[model samples]
Target: MTTSRLEDLDEANLSPAQKVIYDQILSGPRGIVEGPLRVWLKSPKLADKAQALGAFCRYDTNLPPRLSELAIITTGAVWRAGFEWAVHAPIAIKAGVSPQIAEAIRLGQEPQFEAEDEAAVYAFSRELHENRGVSDATYQRCVAALGEEVTVELVGILGYYTFISMTINAFHVPLPAGASDPFPAK
Candidate 1:
């Protein structure tokens, strides 16, 4: 297990502000504090705002679960964020994303997407991560297939997961106890 840059805080030791954010997270779909939240807890206000945005991105987005999970795994793989990849890969599969596709991304290879929507998401996310922006053709393809609102939400999901991947990578956040690292050293 990798040592985190920031120590994980106990609920009892939390300040009043930290306790508020902590309680909010506990009440949310994510009932446990882990991943980026551990680092974000160092700043209670940022933790509150980030968790709210993350809740929207992860749960409230218009993007379908499969597509959202695909984007997350892609972003996590791009950054070699072991904890993120480990957590999301199974969720991606459960959301109907192909296991082969997730495995391919984990190995840094092009995925053979079984659906047009999956291909569009993979292309758009790959372009955004690689080139820092998507090409007009890619954007148009996504819009045509997923509609404007979902496309926008897809981008938001991508951006949010990117932030998550960066946070996990930067802090060297470890996988949950007994969970294996999905992305092993190359």
Candidate 2:
């Protein structure tokens, strides 16, 4: 078994503040403490705030589930964040994203989107991740397709996942048991 890059704290070992945040995560939709949150536990206050933001982006975003998950895997693939990709790829498919589309992103190729909204989300997210900003045309297309509110939430999802991806990468968080890295080194 591969070892985690950081210590994986268990309930028995948690400080009072860490236990509070851990309990909060347990009670949320996540219902488990894993992924970047494991690393975030090192800083309880940061974990609390970030998890709140993440809860909104993951569950309460204005974007449809399909588009939201599309944005998530896009960010994961861009960063080659194995944990993020592994966690979201299945959710994307369950939410109606084609497996082919997710596989294309996994292989670092552009996906062929059958839905215009999916295509728009992909373009908007990919551009923002790769270029640090989206072009006016892409931005306008996203705004037109998703509207200003969801477009903003799309940005939030992208940013939140970026933080998650970076945390996983930085901490060398291990993949779930029996799961291989979806984005292996070239």
Candidate 3:
């Protein structure tokens, strides 16, 4: 299910557990997908951990804003979280990411990033998500582009998003209406 649909949601009521999880998400500046889905997760502690981990990964990590945002929204797109993609895409764009780059991530295609640096950033996000971590070669490429501290941040971003995406998925949270799930029945 996509995160854009509201029709299938448990909007009117939430379990006490779900409420706590929802509260944590809503307290943030912008958290589009986390609230409604927390109810479906049926595990408040896990939900909170996901949210906190996401925040720390996105902001507290040493990654530059643009790189972290790219990693996050790409993760969202891969996971088919309409809400996550919708919310974070613009954040990345505003943080200096090009529209082409954002479009590529949304479409599940690799962007033709002319500059080696930009290509490295995109590849790092892709490889990290694909391999669940950077390979030795990919890590070296990432370090060449981003250096060690930022490389660590990039990996953390990927890991955190993976956790959130899986959480959003396993609970079968309802997607907003008209939103497409990138992954559908085989």
Candidate 4:
């Protein structure tokens, strides 16, 4: 890790409110899972929205894992939500985002693919991330390739990740050290 990133992880400087909740969650049962959600639950509005969004991510039928992860990591890159990128990039990889592809995502680079379907995911996700909305051309291509249900799920997946990005950025969850960090250094 860079000295600068190490400086960022120095927990000694955590805000007082953050420190309090961090300790409570870290001491709770299943701290690893609870920690992130606990931080997001600060606002009732956000918590309810996150719960519904999370269910959609987990249970949505039409979105295959690869495409879902594409939308997720793309939002992570756009938001530069260090912790969001730090967490889900590996899940994307596990769901079949190639190391090369995952690295490209981390560095804000475009994915390379020969298949039109793959290109649609790459293009659609990139467009959604870069523009805060999908381009009509990209949308049409995605719909033609993957159909409307999947296209909607893809957009919803992006919305979910965008929500996560905002929450993680606001409270500043430091990525875990020494584990497989999702957004590995460029």
| Per-model C-alpha RMSD | 1.0, 1.2, 3.9, 6.0
* Residue 141 of model 1, lDDT score: 91
Judging by lDDT against the true structure, name the best candidate. Answer: 2
Say what the RMSD of model 3 is. Answer: 3.9
lDDT for residue 45 in candidate 3, whole number 0-100? 75
Model 1 CA deviation exceeding 4 Å by range = none
The TM-score values for the models, in the order shown, are: 0.96, 0.97, 0.73, 0.73
Report the number of the highest-TM-score candidate.
2
Per-residue CA lDDT of candidate 3, range 1-186, in tens? 534323333645767877776776777744554433454345667767767776688768876777778778878877876556755777889987888888887888878776566667677778766777667887788889888887777777877776666655665555445555444554
- Predict model 1's lDDT versus the native: 0.90
Ranking by lDDT: 2, 1, 3, 4
Candidate 4 lDDT by residue in tens digits, 48-145: 45665676675564877777776777788877766676667788789877878778877877777666776798799778777778778989999998
| Candidate 1 lDDT tens digits, 1-186 | 468888878878999999999999989998988888978998999999999999999999888899999999999999888888888899999999988999999999998877999999999999999999989999999998899999989888888888898899888888877788877775
Residue-pair clash count for candidate 3: 8
**Model 1: lDDT of residue 102:** 93
Can you give the lDDT of residue 62 in candidate 1?
84
How many clashing pairs in candidate 1?
0
